[model samples]
Target: MSIITLSPAILDAQADGRGIVALESTIITHGMPWPQNLEMARQVEATVREHGAEPATIAVLDGTLHVGLTDAQLEKLAQAKHVAKLSRADLAVCMAERRTGATTVAATMIAANLASIRIFATGGIGGVHRGAESSFDISADLHELAQTPVTVVAAGAKAILDLPKTLEVLETLGVPVIAYGQDQLPAFWSREAGLRAPLRMDTPEQIARAHRMRAALGLPGGQLIANPIPAEAEIPRDVLAPVIEQANADAARHGISGKALTPYLLQRIFELTQGRSLDANIALVLNNARLAAQIACRMTLLT
Candidate 1:
């Protein structure tokens, strides 16, 4: 009756006290198309290994929470149809139903924390959606960071969200939003979001130390490492602003809301960008994976 299934590599990493970076599964199941998603998953895991850390891609497969999937398992998950996208609210229910599910940031943090894995890498964390006064729309990813002890590395909040409001909410929740090597926060595909991050750390050592200090102080929340997307791969904010606006408009026109809205907006943006947005997404994810691995390695050294 083991509820959690750790992959052989993950178990070995835990036993050897090696650095292990937890990766979320939503990117494979909800973020991209099939073959490309599979390819991206392989590349992200490879990048983590290349940077001297083991990658533990978290997902739920047949009622089992897997902390690092084998190649065949990854392939099957990638090709599987109609997998539930699990967040904190639905992860346990999906498991109880014996349904396969992909982990969102919240669920991934929960799983990583449960497995004692301290670092996670993702494309971007979700945040306050536009017009929150009326719709009260927000993402659970922010709140999860406020309580989960896993350090999350990302290109920052997805550009589709209200960046300023997201930052405000993170501050309210007492989460440390550290911009990696920069003053301005990154906006997913773009390098700058036109707002200042609350904190900045130039090296992985600094980030690792901060994470350690937080635990030493008995803090409840985790650290957010806002790693910017590579400059060469960025789509530029001015160019993407209108694309995001148009995508949001389209989604609203179609009466999309809640969980269904993100994919719909992303799809419209992808169509508007002529596939450039997806390429930037892939590049940023690889970049974040690299940074996350470096931080994880540093964490092990600190220990």
Candidate 2:
């Protein structure tokens, strides 16, 4: 009858009314190499703590929806091979099958909502993949944002996705895409995606208030805080354009599709960009974690 499971630490923190930020586990199991992924996960959690918030990295282990993970559990999950990358569609199936799976953006949002965690931080969100019109390869993260109430802070949609299409879909679904201190929407590694953002909000207090206002207005979905990568860390759009084009071309040439395309494109982009892309990704995620933690703290005071 248990609908959700909580790690002892998270349960204790929640009981005390501490601000807790929910993180996705797929970044560990599917996003990076073993030691680096584990280390990055630890660093992100620590970043939240340093900003006076508790970190609840969500996942499903052995059929249980874990609201948070222990250090040992994080290590095991980071190193475990062949673990499933779960989204809204297959999240239930993974639990029913009693298998281990890392929560993607959508699944993480679902787990966060169930646990009453309001904030989530990630590198970037998945979106309409190239050729989605024909392939229907839209990410469940889009729909999850349309209905889930967890506020997500990320750089932007992954640069490899169809950015214009992603924004269009978000608009059509009534999901607010607020660019933080910027006029243009950020592309994952780059500071600007060359497209005007739908909304602009400069402060965490403002962002938190917007979330409250959404509830007051009976808005069903969450908001997207498009926090840009640090200026110095960005790869610049022009420089990254050809790189992304090349990666996309290679993906098409190889006929990679579905879930495999993202990882493949990322790895190839890392190679083509000489690892600058990964460096930028880490920077933006940490930046978002700090901002999300601040917002969560403000939300606690406001609510």
Best by TM-score: 1
Instruction: TM-score each candidate.
Output: 0.99, 0.98
Which 10 consecutive residues of model 1 have the lowest summed lDDT?
261-270
Residue range 34-122, candidate 2, lDDT tens digits = 78899999999999999988999998888898998999999999999889999999999999998899999999999999999989999
- lDDT at position 3, candidate 2: 53
Clashing pairs in 1: none
Global lDDT scores for all candidate models: 0.95, 0.93
Give me the overall lDDT of model 2.
Answer: 0.93
Query: Cα RMSDs of all predictions?
Result: 0.6, 1.0
| Backbone N/Cα/C clashes per model | 0, 0
